[model samples]
Target: MRYSKEHKNQTHARIVKRASVKLRERGAHGIGVADLMKEAGLTHGGFYAHFDSRDALVIEAVTHAMDRSTERWRKLSEETPPEKRLSKIVNSYLAPEHRDNPGQGCAVPALAAEIARESSKTRRVFSGRMEQMIDMLADQYPGLPRKAARKQAMAALATMMGSLVMARVTGNSELSDEILKSGRDAVLERAASSEKKPPRRAATSV
Candidate 1:
């Protein structure tokens, strides 16, 4: 049966959306084209109609997931006070709900390990998205120089990702909660401390 352009576009989007969540739930290699197509309520032969290759689908899926995550973070930043933005993001990222539901949370914590083993093109795309995430966090940082703020964002993101990874790996829920709390406190403390410091004076040649 011949499908209209709109129908094809919608179906393509649906496949990518499902692929995004499933990619998070299953590692990069955990899912195959047939299963993804079945989950999308489409035929496996139709996969190539939407994407040139599985790698293409992977890139698109990761991009979709990261974009969804950033959009949520943008909303949080909008609704939150400038001083509280970082904390809100960190709390959301490290929450038990996010930890337990890998398919719905940020892609970084869910797919970072698997992405490292993907193709160079995939890694480059992920790297670019990671920068976007870092820059989003940096935007909320007031008073600090842009460079310093970006560096701070990088560190905070690393901590959040690592803490969540450890939390998920361990059998202890109590320890996991503690890890989240500690990660939050540490990031917030650093942010608060940075806010208190005076920006360095520019050097003047004598």
Candidate 2:
């Protein structure tokens, strides 16, 4: 039986949502179209109805994941004061809850490397999404010009992403926890340093 337009849209959303989580839990190439469709509670034959190819689904999935993450960041930051926004973001992202749950966590650390090696179309889409994330973070950083803030955002994100990767892969749980803490602390330090005013020269004694 043929589904209505609304039903088709819902099905398409379900497929993209499931694919988003699966792609993060497993790398970009780790999931196949058949498996994705199956997890989405649909038959493999319907996969082409939503997307032209597995790559198309992947692009949609990555965009969906990153957009969700950015929205979450905005929500979390909104609850905190302006000065503490970046700190709050860093801490929450590196928190144990996020670290232990890679499937629902940020896509940057999960699928970035694999996406890097994918087709140019995928890379361009991923790049654009990632830049949006960076630009969002850049705005939260204070005391810096826009260009400088963008650089700081890049550095902060790099540290957080690398630390998260190590934390996830390390054999010891204690080390994993430490890695998370260090990443949070490091980002907070970076934020603090950026906000520091220049030291003034002391007045000479007569």
Per-residue lDDT tens digits for candidate 1, residues 51-112, read: 99999999999999999989999999899997788889988988888888889888888889
All candidates' TM-scores? 0.95, 0.93
Candidate 2 per-residue lDDT over residues 1-206, each given as its tens digit: 98999999999999888988999999997788887788888899988888998899999999999999999999988899997888888988998888888889999999888998999999999999889999999989767878888998999999999999999998349989999999999988878877795645789999
Residue 5, candidate 1: C-alpha displacement in angstroms: 0.8
Q: Any residue pairs clashing in model 2, and if so which?
A: none
Residue pair clashes in candidate 1: none
lDDT of each: 0.89, 0.89
Model 2, CA-based lDDT: 0.89
Superposed model 2: Cα runs more than 4 Å off: 199-206
Cα deviation in Å at residue 110, candidate 1? 1.5
